[model samples]
Target chain A: MDAMPKWADVVLIPLISLILAAILSALVILAIGESPTKALMLMIDGALGSTYGWGYTLYYATNFIFTGLAVSIAFHARMFNIGGEGQAMIGGLGVALVCLFIPWPHWSLALLGGTIAAALFGAAWAAIPAFLQAKRGSHIVITTIMFNFIAAALLNYLLIGALKPKGSMEPATGKFPEATHLPNMHEVLAPFGIEFSKAAPANISFFVAILACFAVWALIWRTKLGYEIRAFGHSESAAKYAGISPTKIIMVSMLISGGLAGMMAINNVQGEAERLVLNAVEGAGFIGIAVALMGRSHPFGVFLAAILFGFLYQGGAELALWTKIPREMIVVIQALVILFTGALDNMVRMPLERMFLAAKRRNKGAA
Target chain B: MELLTILQVLDSTMRLATPLLLACLAGLYSERAGIFDIGLEGKMLAAAFLSAAVAYTTGSAWIGLLAGIAASLGLSAIHGLASITFRGNQLISGVAINFLAAGLTVVVSQSWFGQGGRTPQLAGSARFEPITLPFAEALRDIPVLGPIYYELISGHTALVYIALLLVPVTWWVLYSTRFGLRMRAVGENPAAVDTAGVSVVGLRYAAVIICGVLCGIAGAYLATALQAGFVKDMSAGRGYIALAALIFAKWRPWYALYACLLFGFLQALALRPDVIEGVLGFKVNGQLLDVLPYILTVIILAGFVGKAIPPRAGGEPYVKER
Candidate 1:
């Protein structure tokens, strides 16, 4: 069978699936006694209408970008690294320790230290599962998921036992020193006279997320290591015969993935909260899977998908605030998107493929 | 003092283990039939919510249990349709189901009852009441065995007994029945089973439906028997823990029982701070204990415990041409 045209395959199918998801979401809203068109308008207005909205949207987009790249890297190695939630938690710990203990004279230096520490800690947490999968044939999915819960419990222990402020009842660390606070989007954009929201959490870390996407693209598509990782993912036995070591590919790819996941903490923890808190990751790791899948694991595609989700999140918040719709409806919308895009993907693709095939046949007959 | 402490721990273990055991057995059926169901949590959550809502409305726990089973079966059918019928990725479908359940439970609950995604508190006949065995008063005078029989074994909701009975029933069906053999065969090698003239899809659907039934009971047990009503995200991570237990058991029924009990014991220990305080002579962090099942599952999967080989055809959808 002939493959579908690249343009149609890459662009058309996802577009159709997304439309289907949106239609279903709209129907669900109608069932709940709300107007779907109005909901969409509210979402757009709240997410993209103002600098304030963009600030929040971009801040969320930054988190998604880090996690999407993380998931994409592991997908390239044929590994499902579901431990991102846990990995990011540990990464926050690393960021907290660096910002708390190190007396950096400048915010930039603190950012550098925290980024390195977060990546290292995330990598370390991921290493155990990677090694087990490489050496012992443990299923990466099961092990990584287990690690997520373990990470949560481990973080809980640290916060309650050692990390909590001397007399604070809350299970969170004391605020970081002011020197470690990253520049918000307003401050960063003001030098260029681009007015932005002062209160929005979008910060310098957003740039870092964009940079990470480029690095991942270069690593996955351009480098020799990238070739080996893709080769292993495509066919491990064939790649083994071609001299790619499964152990090396799996371990390296997962380490990079874990590092990317950990870096997400820099955006949320150091960049926004300026402190380590419980549930800081807030299901962003799980959301990454959908982002990576929707993006087709491409860097540029991931960027677009992340922004779309950012819109949904900010807009969903608006819908909850203004309409009688509960905040959980956002999850339903997101889930429908995932259902159509990731799971029932073929429902859109097979028909599109058939249509493309018939068009080619018609052209042949006419010629 | 020691005996009483032991009894208390054991009692809590029994209560906690019931849900885990039911869910683990549910996963076992699906996985054994070659469908990887990570959606057990979702199914349980749906069941828990629907059952509570129905029970509260109708004032009958029995009808609620039926409603929960029907809701769970509906979800199981969706999973089967996506993974088996549409030939989509099983893991992705499972994740979607989980997300759907989590979101839908809250949305529907709010529409129906309007208590921030919670059902009204179940009371009277709407809840599962503890059942005391005959001669409980007479048995109380006896020492260790008496407490074990009357306290630990008896005097719990009927769902606990049903879950315990399912262990042996699951074993008998899987080993002694033709359907069980065919189900196992379908999981290990669907092509071989197809070649033998048995319908692979039929067996898988059956396994999935049974899995849904078990998950429904587990959910009903949680909402009605244990907690008295449904709360949002009430299943917590128990489904994943049950999956881990299924892995630790290496997909066997009896071993699944043991694995669930062990996990439940860990959970009970974590919940009861006094237990650790009593044993260690000081506070031992419950968080560590809270994470013990997950940590142990990772270790077990890593081959520190033993070798665990999943069904060869577990995640693959059988395509005849391929």
Candidate 2:
């Protein structure tokens, strides 16, 4: 009884939305008196042309992967965990605390410690809003948003007062010990005789991000909890009739979502920054929303969407450096993608469904 | 501890609260009419930039206000098109608008001004100037009432008075007129209103446009009246605080004013922590006050302090059943 095939539903729709967004983005660049074709060439050359560009792109992709998964899981549960920003920021704090206070003998142990701390802190941050949403009737969207501001204030205080290193005027912690320094892509790939840009921040965390994709794919498709979560999302009343606990589903999904989001701290704060910075998460948390939307909340789809966004981000930086195009161009592109894919989805979908139905009727008549 | 210091803090609170009050009221109309808009921040940010840019270019504050309203209305139209016409996710549409403004304003401002996403400083006639009440100097000798009139109420810009004046007007419109009754009813039960032969779409759009106008004024006040120029991301979190205030007020008009003022007082206290430090006999952390409104709102949200129930049909796009 579906209007179109599953492949078209999953792939074709997002593709069309992306193309429409790209066209609008080209017009926006043109409106600012820049050549769209030239900008495209620059983006390709900057993001995908060399190993260096790939290194930076993959680094950003790592951060996006974690966040995108966080958002994807929550989207499956039909809960908007907009507090990814806060959770990720708190995850950075956890990473900072673990790195600065704990003495690890090797990077492997440190990574494990940081990862555990990040997930726990991130999950704990999400738990409060999840608790309220489950027990009380408070909207998760508003509560998560309020939490973002609170997280920012909390970070601002800790960075200035307690976590700050002596003689450093900046609101950031001191660097982690050399024992905890992560190996870059260059080092990680050296054994295979492959060269990567050493200057780039792409590191072992990128592999972790890839593993997370597989894990999320398996978890969402293969697990009993996933069944309950999806069933609850599809119909709360039906799920309740089937004996699924709504409160448990809400809490468990949010905790996993928050944990995935927190894993981004391992990539950005631990892998890249080395020392936790005030603007550690930046707007990557919000970008996760667009990634999840465009990906249709599928892990494999999320991986591709994250790569596309990472390319836009790194390419936009290149445009800022070389041309008159501002870096906010990527943001505009992200917004357009979200608009076309998420909000105005039916605008594109309704027409496509009619065309498909007509084709199906024609094929049946010919048979 | 001193009377003058307390009066000064209260004075600062009035200025800080103006933007929050206007935005809270803006949210009031939209949520009351069954269209949830988290894009108020985005609208305010856009309006702030456009208003500052226009005022700087035309050297007229009024023209800037108009331009700001125009920008906000444009965004509102997009929201209406997506949510009302296409029946898309309202929250998704709102998130898009927010990102749109956050990015577009910076792009446009950087290209137009070349001041790195900032408008040029607006001077006299380009910005709102404070208006002194009549005979304020004549009453300066009076002990308590003189300072209250002169320091607290008399020296605000036109928008402050406009914001204060809108409270009662809003209350009257929400409770009095036929349009007001339809607006409230559309939010609560659009089907009921539709059954009563009212166009639910028309009423919702009207509510959205009203929301846009209020956000426009709120942004204009932030840039032209309060700061005298627009910087990138200058709207900051006032939009979110206004949202918290809206929830705190339970979507009523008068309570919005009180909530905004209370939040604004916290803002004022954060700005000058010495006043708090002197009283507490210890240095109070600035971050705590900055985080207070959010925590308080969360408490209200959790039903620990008070209950805040939203409009029944809020956040759901209305579809006519065949």
Candidate 3:
């Protein structure tokens, strides 16, 4: 009975969440004095209406996917990795430094070096709090939050003072050398009659994101380490009794989480833009939590959820152009999705489980 | 010669520390009742925006202060309901509330005031003026003690005085009052508190609401007293700093007060490069100074202050079963 219910949980849970999101969106649209039908139509059209729109959506979705996976990786170990913002910032800094200061003859080598540098920086940043939590028992939430502030200050200082581009008032680093940028695939797509605008900076990052999803899926599902991580997440005491070190597992989980977050810089620096700018992450790390939650902390779930979020983001911007609504409404909608999904998870879990159990029992009786 | 300059810095520190002190104390109450009040930042932001807006409209600082407290109380009520009644995850709910407040305050401020993410600038009459004490002025004629009193106690904002007064009051309430005992009990073990005939939900709600009120006042102080208006994200992670202070102070009110003051001093020191240069007698990178408090917070949390243990049942919601 339990086994059947657990199996059904995978399918039914997300369906219920979507329905709940729709109802919640309706209520929000009504409250804000908009027609729900028209608003949602606008949302769908803006997200998927044109080739360019879809490309832009996919471009942003790629970053969301990486960050979402980063967050989900930590959640698997029952850790709330709020350091995603800090990790991403530090990683971007590393990428920018490598691209600008280090001389690379080949674009591919520079890109690879920049991405690896970001991952290492992010890993080091996360390792501090992990060490604190493991060695000193400091709360991960508070420590990570503190690191976020430090990262912000550090990024601001570096951008403004050390890495500021010549003749620019904005707080941003110098552009990467031509060799460091990812080869733009937009032109390649154009030969096939796909019109890729400069505004749509879609590149190979989307493929990288998909590959990351598969990698994480395999890491969590196929490996012995994944089993230990799941076991630890289920019950720390049980895992401890089974000879797993909680401290080591926590440190490893946080390191991986941070490293994945660092990979986000590759999308931003190499794929999307050539410069390191302030607010480059732009709350992506924080929004990753909502994405992870909506995805139910699963790899494929995170992928689909990232695309959904990317749609809302691009669509929200487009909707702003057509309506009086501000772009910030997208943020409100995102928050609303998180609220509804979180609440619906509890509301639907038991009823669906009961229904699945009853069907399983009936089938067994007939057999 | 430099000793006097240090004293002046200390004086400036007290004034800078007042709002954070109030906020940390506010967080202390909620956390002691087993509710994670990460929404302190949101509460403060809402209060700051409302206070500034109301003060500008009404032309009364007192009214603005009251309005700020009322605004914060309303937000706290939402937090209390979600966490206590619905048994939601305290941290996530708090984050949602924070993000909501961050976006909502800016949206409303932009729409209502048209000031581009801020309230209108408040006049002196609509702001909390510093209070000057005659005794302290008279004492300044004396030696070192007189300088200490004159510098630290004189010409500070009214909220600073209120914050100082709250320390003993908080101690009294937390240690002596039956309500405080029950609140602590609920934090330590909600089940035990529930079995002891106390309503855990009610106590937690009350604690959170009080936290809201305190955060509101702190917010108002930021807008009306500390500065003159609200800016987008003006709280600027001060709420988290206050939470760090709460832990650093071991969750005790007086200790929390000191912790807030220390952080506030760091902030003031970071802001004034001239003073830092004068004191250190060398060139200091301005960015390093700016990042000092955050680095200190990380260090403190890591091991500097040793382990700051939270209540055993801190983030758990109470559910009564027969």
- Candidate topping lDDT: 2
lDDT of 1 by residue, A211-272 (tens): 99899999988999999999999999999999999999999999999999999989999999
Q: What is the lDDT, from 0 to 100, of the residue A198 in candidate 1?
A: 96
Question: Where does model 2 sit among the CAPRI classes?
Answer: high
Candidate 2 on B1-322: residue-level lDDT in tens?
Answer: 7778988999999999999999999999999999999899999999999999999999999999999999999999989989998999888898899999989999989889888888999999999999999989889779988988899989899999999999999999999999999999999999999999999999999999999999999999989999989998998988899999999999999999999999999999999988988888888888999889999999999999778999999988888974
Point out where model 3 deviates above 4 Å: A1-42, A165-170, A188-193, A319-324, A343-367, B1-8, B134-152, B319-322
Chain A TM-score per candidate? 0.98, 0.99, 0.92
Clashing pairs in 3: none
User: Residues A113-215, candidate 2, lDDT per residue (tens digit)?
Assistant: 9999999999999999999999997999999999999999999999998889889999999998988788999999999999888998899999998999999
DockQ, every prediction: 0.76, 0.81, 0.39
Please tell me how candidate 3 rates in CAPRI terms.
acceptable
Query: Which residue pairs in candidate 2 collide?
Result: none
* Chain B TM-score, structure 1: 0.98
Residue B276 alpha-carbon offset, candidate 1, angstroms: 2.7
Q: Local distance difference test, per candidate?
A: 0.90, 0.93, 0.82
Candidate 3 residue lDDT tens string, B1-322? 4657878788778877888899999999999999987788888998999999999999998899999999899878767866787677777777766776786676667667766678888887899998888898778879878887778778888888888999999999999999999999999998888888888888998899889989999999999999998888888888888888888887999889888888888877876778877767987777676566667767877777576788888988787884
Tell me, by TM-score, which candidate is best.
2
lDDT rank order: 2, 1, 3
